[model samples]
Structures are given as C-alpha cells and as structure tokens.
Target: MNGHEQGNSRAAPSRLRIVVDTDMGVDDAAAVAWLLSQRERPVELAGVAAVWGNTGVDAAAVNVVALLRALGREQVPVVMGEAAPSSGPMSPIGSLVHGADGMWGRAAGTIATCPKDLVAFYRAVAAADTTLLALGPLTNLTRVAALAPDVLRRFARIVVLGGAWRHGSITPVSETNFWHDPEAADRVLAERLPIVLVTRDAHRAFALTHDDLAALATAGSPAARYLAAPMRAYAQVTGRFGEPLNFPDVVAAVLAVEPAAATVRRSALVRVVTGTHGLVRGQSVMGFADNERLAMIEGGAALARLVEQALAEPTLHLGRALAAILAREPDNAEVVLAVDAARVRRSFLCALTREART
Candidate 1:
C-alpha cells in the first residue's frame, strides 16, 4: 500500500504537502510547472525554495515565481534557497544546461516575496508531515539535517533529484548535484529517514521524447509553450551525446503521492564522496541491508498523464485530482498503468513531433 493508504480515514495524511527546491533549469521548470498544474490534486504546493545549481540562486528564485504565476500559482510562496554549496568556490554548470537566467532569465521582482531562510522554512513546514522534494543541491536540506535531525524525521519522506546510486551526469560516477555539495549530500543520505534517492540510473527511465514536447505545445497553454522550448533545448544537448535526459525527479514528485505504482529497492547504508571523477570523487557506499526500499515507480504514461492533467488547469496543479482518483482504487496497479499509458502517449506524440522539426 502507498503512504496515502493504510492510514486512519479520519486523520489521514493531509494530502502530500511538498516543498520543492529547484535550480530553475529547463527540466526543473517543467517539474515545477508540473506541480503548479496539479491544482486539483491532493499534493499541496506548500512552498518553493530556489537553490543555485543550473543558475544563480537569485535567478532560480525569479524563475520559480515566474513559473508559478504563469501556471497561476502566484499564491504559492517562492523562497530563495541556498546560493550555492556552503563550501569552497565553484564554477557554474552551463548556460545551455539551465538557460541564461535559469528559467529563461526572467525578473526576480515577479515573485511576491523572497523567502528569508530556506533551511528554516523547510524545517517549519516539515513538522506538518510534508515531503521535501530537493530538485537542486542538498545545501538547504543538509543544513536542516544538521540543525534539526527531528525535522528530517518530521516529514514522512524526502525525495531528492540528485545523486547516482549507480552513476552520475557530469562524470562517469558522480552526479552534478552531489559533486556540487558532496558534504551535504553525504550528510542527508547518512540519515535513515524515509528517503528516496531518484538516482541517475532510475531517472533515465523517464526520458522525455520530442513527441512529448510537441503534444504539450499543441495543448496551446502557457505551460505547454513554456515546456516545449526547454524540452527542445534538453533534446539538443542530449542528442549531441546521444543520451536521454534523466527525468526520474519528475516521476518522483508524482510518485510521492501514489508510491504503490512503482517497483521499490532498498539501500540500508548509503554514502556519497566528493569531487569530480577521481580517487575521492562523489561515490556512494552501502553499509548494510535496509528493509526500506527506494520505490522504483516507473509509469511514464501515468506520470505524463499527471503532468498533462496538472498543466491542463494552468494555474494550480493541486493534488486533489490525484487524491480523488486515488481514493477509489488505492491499491490497483492496472488502474495506474492505464492512466500512465494514456498520458504518456499524449505527451510523447507532441514532444516527438516538436523535436523532429527543430
């Protein structure tokens, strides 16, 4: 059964309260857009914290608010997260990777109010049993882990888009997020709190095809247009290397609600090393076998459907839609599969067409 299920009906989880930390990259924008589109779902857009990864922290913060407003989620708080790793100086990733000003280099003034401290913001809401989705570096999360270990346990789960249980994106073994802040990644993973590390290996399964973008664009919504361009850019870079963009993070966000629709694997003791591909690069080691498995939920179609449904409304992708559908069949895989396939096909066709022309 999923976390939403097997709970007291009277006081069951108050929807999947989530605080998403993003760097405002193209994919990051899409993920945020996906969440914003879910206004009718059970997941609550508690807050959005921007961290420096694909772009500057300031840029990321602006992008978050712009995306929220464009998607009609201006009410959702857009907080500025960590500027960068709280360690030595580091170089920016690349403009092509995350665009000029992170999410299209928009203005920061767009955001209603910038958050004071991302770590503290996360700590406060986490106590309400929210799931923290770390889409960027784990700096804020690491800070929280160090300051209040209870906050880590307060949330039912923490879904991180970084780390590579098997490999990395910048290197053969080290992912960029972990490499940027290995100390933080290591600290967060060291904790045994119910966590799901959507590693590169698992993320590869949710690659977005050109067809997907095309379909989204054809949808003729602001989000669809917003999603189409970056998606196209992502395809360009990946096509150069003949690789697909690892998108497990987006899937993880959706699965945070309906986890039973996935195949989970457990890692008891997980650790991450620092640096680029070298002797002491970012490496993960398992200390012991843990009963808790990282739920490997792979329903591209279902996720695509969720994305579409979330984006359909444009303003707010609340978790009410997912909750409503989920309330009926809380433990049925076939039902989830049906939703997944239908959604995937729609997005795949559109994205695929857009990529071909561009």
Candidate 2:
C-alpha cells in the first residue's frame, strides 16, 4: 500500500497542504505552476522553500517569487533554503542543464525578503496535514531532520524527486539531486521518515518531445506561454546530449497529489552512497529481495556488475560499508517503480492551460 493508504483510518482531509522545497530550475518552476493550477484537485500550495541546485539559493528564490507573481499567486510565500550541499561546494552541473540564471535569465531582479527560519516554518506546518515535496537536493530536509527530528516526522508524507533504479542522469549511477548532496540524501533516507521516492525511471518516461512544446506554445494560456520558451530552451540543451527533456519534479508533484498516477510502487530498503570520492558517490542502492518486480526492474546481472565496479574502487570502501549497514535496516521508503506517462502528460498540460485558482 502507498503512504496515503497506510495512514490512520480517519476521514481524509479535503485539501492536501504542500510545501515545496525546490531548486527552482525550469522544471521546478513548471512543477510549482502545475500545483497552483490544480483548481479542481484538493491541493493547497502552502509555501515554497528554494535551495541551491539549479542556481544559487537567492536566484532560486527570485524564480519562485517571479513565477508566483506571473501566476497571480504571489501570496504564497517563498523562503531561501540551504546555500550549499551538506558536505561540499554546490555542483555546477545544474547550470549546464538549466542555464546560468537557472530560469534562462527570464526571471531576474530582486524581491523583498524576510528572515524566515526553515526549521521554524516546518515546525509550524508539520502540525497540519502537510506533505513535503522535495524537488531538489535534500540539504534543507536534512537540516530539518538534524534540528528537529520530531517536526520532520510529523509530515504526513514526503515525495522526493530523485534517485534512479536503472540509470542516472548525472553519472552512471547517480541522479542529479542526490549526486549534488548525497550525504544529506543518505541522512534523510536513513531517518526512516514517511517517504515516497519518485525516481528517474518513472519521470523519464514522461519526457517532453518537440511536439509537446509546440502544443504548449500555441495553447495561448498565460502559464503555458510563460513556460514554453524556457522549457524549449531546456529541451535544446538536453537535445544536444541526445536526451529528451524530463520533468522529474513535476512527476513527483503529481504523484504526491494524485497517487493513482503511480501505476507501480514498492516498499524497499534504500541507501545512498555518501562517499566524497568515488565513481558511484551518490548512487542509490535499493534492496529488492522481497519484491520480485523490483528485482526485475533492476536486473541481477547489472546490479552485480555495478557492485563489482564499486568494489574495484578503493575510494568506495567506506561507502560500501555504510551501504551494508543500511541494508540491514527496515524498509524506509515506497519507491515509485512505474507511472502512467500518458496520464501524467495530460494532467500537466491541462494544468498549464487552465487559469490559476485563487
């Protein structure tokens, strides 16, 4: 059963309270826009926390505010999150995919800010039926786990947009978000919080082709018009690499609000490689012994080769030891093994074409 099904036998809330912790990349902006456009769904975007990933935290916050302004939802507060990863300097790979200004330099300029405490904000929101949608590195969530474990535990569920069961985007075995801050990802997963991991395997299936962008550009809605150019720019960059434009964050957001979007999910013991220097530094190793479907998703021969390669590297010895310990732990997360790609694309496009609800 998914997290929602496993919840206490009580009447479900009319609306889901969501606080998005994002890096505000192009996809992240699109994800937030989709959330705000859920006029018929029971979704309430409580707030947004911008972190360092696609760009610096300041630029991310600016992007959030600017997007909110364009959507007429400026009242939804945006706060700056961790300025860097947990244990190292911020990664520069984000700019290669998202451009230097994160939003293709479209959403620039400053906005008035306040000294909002992330931990304090979580503490307050945790009391409600809140779901945390993490669309970037887990640095800010890890900080919450460290400063206030109780508060972190109080969330109804956390939908994370990272990890890869078969292949990763950043490296051979590492997804971008976890690769940016593996240490933080490791800690958050090990904390045993109620987490639903939306991996690349599911999101990549919903990639946007050139035709999809063409449809959006002519859709004539404000949200679609605002997003079409940046999304097309993003597609251009990734196209050169022979990859389609994937919106992993938007996939996670949809699954968070609409669980049926996930056609296949499994409970598993998951671990992240936290080693500072290794070929698989941020690799997500999932133990799928109990689930035959999961085992099939990650072929045994392939997994063995990955392990063999890791063992061959002396720099990964400590990470291997850490992974061994986490393997013994109970299942910590429900992994989204598959999703309804057509349904997700339709929902995303429909949201973009609709007017934002007040």
Candidate number achieving the greatest TM-score relative to the actual structure: 2
lDDT minimum window of 10 residues, candidate 1: 330-339
lDDT (C-alpha, whole model) for all candidates: 0.62, 0.83
Check candidate 2 and list the clashing pairs.
Answer: none
Query: How does each model score on TM-score?
Result: 0.72, 0.84
Q: What is the lDDT of candidate 1?
A: 0.62
lDDT of 1 by residue, 8-59 (tens): 3454345668878777777777666665554335668788887787887877
Task: Report model 1's TM-score to 2 decimal places.
Answer: 0.72
State the number of backbone clashes in model 1: 43
Model 1 misplaced regions, further than 4 Å: 1-14, 38-41, 106-113, 275-280, 287-358
lDDT by residue for model 2 (1-358), tens? 7787778566555887898999999999888888887654767788888889999898888888888888888788677779999887887888987889798977867473834598887776674489999999999999989998888888889999988888787888788899999999989998999999999888889877677788888877668877888898898999899987788888998998899999989888788888675779888888766443334344567556666877798677745643454455678899998999888888887787652221
